[model samples]
Target: MRGGDLVVRVLKYLVSVAFLALPLAAQADELQEAPAPDAAAPVPSSSDTILVTATRLAIPVDQVPASLTVLDKPAIDRAQDIGVTELLLRTPGISISRNGGYGTTTALRIRGAESEQTVVVIDGVKLNDPSASSGGYNFANLLAGDASRIEVLRGPQSILWGSQAIGGVVNVVTALPAKTLEGSFDVEAGSHETVSARAAIGGKTGPLAWRLGGQAFTTDGISALAPAFGGKEADGYINRNVSGRAVIELAPGISADLRGYYASSQTEIDASTADSLEYSLNREFVGYAGINLDLLDGRFRNRIGYTYTDTDRDNFNPTRARAQTFDAAGHNRRLEYQGAFAIAEGWTLLAGAENERSRFRSASPPAALATPVPAPVRGGADITSFYGQLSAQPIGGLTLNAGLRHDDHDRFGGKWLFAAGGVLNLPTGTVLRASYGEGFKAPTLYQLFSEYGVASLAPERAKGWEAGAEQHLFDDKLVFGATWFQRKTRDQIIFNSCAATSTDALCFVPGNATTRRQGYYANVSRAEAHGIEAAAALKLGSFQLDGNYSWTVAEDRSPGANFGKWLPRRPRDTANGSVSYAWPFGLTTGAAIRWSGKTFDNAANTTVLDAYTLVDLRAEYALSPSLRLIGRVENLFDETYSTAIRYNALGRVFYAGLRGRF
Candidate 1:
């Protein structure tokens, strides 16, 4: 039998098994990073804090069975990082690679998983560009504009989030009005003629609350290709963004919400590893509308919502006759209903159903006018899903959860996933956690119908398990944690290259024996990953310290020449550390260090990516209760480095800004 036939048989078996265990995954999709109506706000210094990303319902951090990191406004401001991706790098279980400086193509991977496997959510709306090669969100344009909190949930999370969540989830919650009238602003300028300015205003009145914000940033950046590669031309970048959110009361226990986010960016790129006068334009829009209602005296809450996302991308090469090289657009629309019911004091049930539709159209224009632009490749897919989860506390300080999700895809049909985990919090200030999760990723539209696509590809599947422990001492002043995790993936999708003398049946385009193809999407037999993550935080008097380390070994374990080789671009070790102190005179100073081990640049492990370290210094002075002056020197030592081969990393740069809140 051929590869396609074998995939069909396996899928049928999984579908039958999914239907056998359908009802256990009952979890709501409310995604309230903030507390629920009845749950009180979390105190910054508390050991047990509330978070909702794990199960999409408010729960304390100790009760969550997975590893998670929360960055509140104070932390975000103190870090003084301009990009959200930069902020995430300080946390555990995450790694990043960028082609150049700000506003360049970026890849963020979690726990050794592929970049496309992670899911990004903003204010309860999912983000991805289906028209892209891998159908993933680019962190290049994602900034920390007007964001109050951001959560990083590591590991497979497809039980609550749907497909493409094999790695984990990044949940970002923007600011919401809390006072009758409030506002804030920030302005900064730094090296390379970089300037950034942003402001926000919001207010809460009787039955209405609203917030609006905007940001603008520009920089003359370093070369896309490394200076070591004989590249010297500068590449510039600019970005503009706007966001708004509103909640209106409709009745005693009901309300409606409207939210939107828009961003436009332009970045100068290069021709391969050489300098060239080329550039790209990108735009992203996210909109959501929802209504909330409560019944049984707030014991049960329900929400119905609609979300839409659109991404537009274009590339121009001035050297070409037409200049315009690529154009693409992707759109996603989703209708969902979510419910959360407090079955009892320590027991809860969450459920949700959703229908998501994705469409994409793309084309590459030819240089010569004699030939017309090939008819744009257009494709669309729909996924209808129902999921549920149950959590209960049968004994003091012990919480357990189980969940299930079933998805019916227009192309792949039915698939189901299951997850179970437990957390034990002891009176001795120690917590133990363990979990098992299942994940899957359907082939992207581009992978199935594009010029080099194979229409008969199957979805990839993965399973992972983790165990960890945490200890807090001295009234939560000193805390440390570590986790060990392992995962296996089957039928991983990869691009297969056909050699000139190859005789593989797949070398020829379908239905045309004479037409040989250079490359096509195919499934890898297997892959494996395992790692250890350790983190600690210390708070003593006016001084504080935080640090994390990761040891990841992701390998291709298939029965081929590449077996046991390290996966591309995944370092075996990475670590981050920071220390800060505050003086009695309203001054705070801090320094940070980041280090990474060497990594392979390709699947065959023939190319080597050297490791490097960087240092940074930051300081802040409080002018008043609501105002402050901030300055930071990034890459303080001007250490030259590269995250991706032949790509230059930012060197020494300085920035100073004023922040105000009211």
Candidate 2:
């Protein structure tokens, strides 16, 4: 069938679904909010609601001594974006640089920290890939379809998350089942032959609550590089994902829960030249099971969980037919136990223990036939950890928090980390908060056992502090917040130059260390980053306005050729804002703007990346109580720009879709 015909058929089907929900509109008046449902998720009594990620315990946002942002289901629906990174760009202190448009290599930097320094968690499983040289979570193929809530904590959290939390943490939670049977489906088609479809079913039955979801997406993406720079062909991408969760009550105060997610994608890539047709296949799986027990009449809670994660990746040159160019697989297993107890009327204690093992294997063909073929490489590591935290309300309108952790690695022995913080409330809805924390990151398998790996490297360390103030006015209708943070890192690892004249100890040639230099990973640098983040919001009746700005100064303080230079792909200034209004007729219209300042593509600042501004417009109409029509015009101004050197960004695009629930 022709592309035009396919789009027409999809449009008709979606319209029919929307109309089917019209009959449900007549019963809308019978709907009522449910009672206390999910633990760690308390019903909101006011705008300043409570969240669980900040402390691993339910606490009000204004009372937590940390900088955090929560993007709930309603906020996500307003954006109407398919990719997770697209929505994250509107968050404060978050920046991204992707090599191309959709399904490309994307990196996220939080609060002037490197992309690899942040941590990402879904459900109870950490998303970092052990096989990756940088040991970071890739955001390229992460879609927003199954995510019901996302919590961003911006600061060092090693005391609670163990490793790779020097920058911060991102926690994604899936939607839970409602009391009654409910299901939803959405379909969208847009520019570049792009099409996306998603469906979900969820409800509670007797002692069980469950949700199942699936999504399919495809797009003929733009070139990875500009035509002027030799890009000649458009890369394409396809993704399929499935997610599920279930909870069953064993008895009156005991429950068991399970969660799983799987995703697979094939993304076209560019080689040295523009005409190359290379593609990569990626598969990721995460699953976990846990049992929760509430004792002492709900004053004490305990959880025991086990998690498993696996990943497989391959890159191939389709022109070469059956020849496999590269292949890799990684697996991780973890067991954990946590407990929370109310020690006193105004104090609570939190503690947890974890054990994890990670393994990886990889194989790659040589670049030339004459080059000797290398055998497959294998590596593994084990880690054990214990952590404790105390939260106290020692005085009126004041809260104090302190936490500590100890980690023992199979190779590196042991390390200790800690964090201390407090929040003070003043007259008329004013809050003051401050926190200090230390973090550490262990070497990845690729860094210690790969072909050019170095096993003698030590773990990198960091120290950081932040102070912030928030003011609420007009009964929480208007809010203003600002935070200032600074961080210093020691023994940062980086690939060193391999020039013959270089004196770096870690850059020695294989089997001829005394004569020549060869590139290798080493921990030989110190760096510093400082930034200011500010946010404002106004809500009055049916209109809402929100904005956030970040001023970051990220420099390499190492004593070398790149000393005191700006970090790559990090702009000095960035801001995001949106103005939205809802009509009584069940129609909502909104506009959003994202602005980024100039950035560099190299440590020497030789390749300058032009700044850009993007504007998007969205509208939604409720066709019935259970159906909604959504439309979005992205890149409304058609601004030509690039987040990375040589890459071509997207142009103007339009998308229309409908969502229906029953």
Local accuracy by lDDT, each model: 0.86, 0.82
Q: Tens digits of per-residue lDDT for model 1 on 246-286? A: 98999988989888999999999875569978999999999
TM-score of each: 0.93, 0.91
Q: Candidate 2 versus the native: TM-score? A: 0.91
Model 1 lDDT vs. the true structure? 0.86
- Candidate 2: tens digits of C-alpha lDDT, residues 418-485: 99999998888999999999999998887887765788889899999999999989988999999999
The reply for model 1, stretches above 4 Å from the true place, is 1-48
